[model samples]
Target: MYYIVGMHIHIVPNRGSRPTILLRESYREGKKVKKRTMANLSHLPMHQVELLRAVFQGADLQPAGLG
Candidate 1:
């Protein structure tokens, strides 16, 4: 049985430094929610990372004049 809910971006905080940005997949088993890291997005630029996050969240960011 292969069942996965969705994927999303996750931020991991560091004690005295910048945090890590990760792309994770979420799944539910019984009554527990578990997440698995799919990729490490810490090396990407902040704007690019934000765009990817928005896409995952189903945001409609089309060009203003290209509608």
Candidate 2:
């Protein structure tokens, strides 16, 4: 079975637009590693993105405006 073991953050560049920040889950399936996107954080501000990054790092605090 595939199991998610951690979260990963990625920044994707775009032309004529701000870079996109993505949240993904890292999964382990036997000896292989796989990743799946969990959220698209491109619309969020930098501060909020930092906050969410903290959450992904196992912080107990919750970020606002994530609806």
lDDT winner = 1
Residue range 1-67, candidate 2, lDDT tens digits: 5455898678889999989899988887778988889999888899878887887788887347664
TM-score to true structure, per model: 0.81, 0.68
Error of 1 at 42 (Å): 0.4
Per-residue lDDT of 15 in model 2 = 100
- For model 2, the stretches where C-alpha displacement exceeds 4 angstroms are 1-4, 59-67
| Residue 38 lDDT (model 1) | 95
Model 1 C-alpha lDDT per residue in residues 1-60, reported as the tens digit of each score: 777589999999999998899999999978899988999999999899999999999998
* Cα-based RMSD of candidate 1: 2.2
Lowest summed-lDDT stretch of 10 residues in model 2?
58-67
- Assess candidate 1 and give its TM-score to the true structure: 0.81
Candidate 1 Cα errors over 4 Å, as ranges? 1-4, 63-67
Estimate every model's Cα lDDT from 0 to 1. Answer: 0.92, 0.83
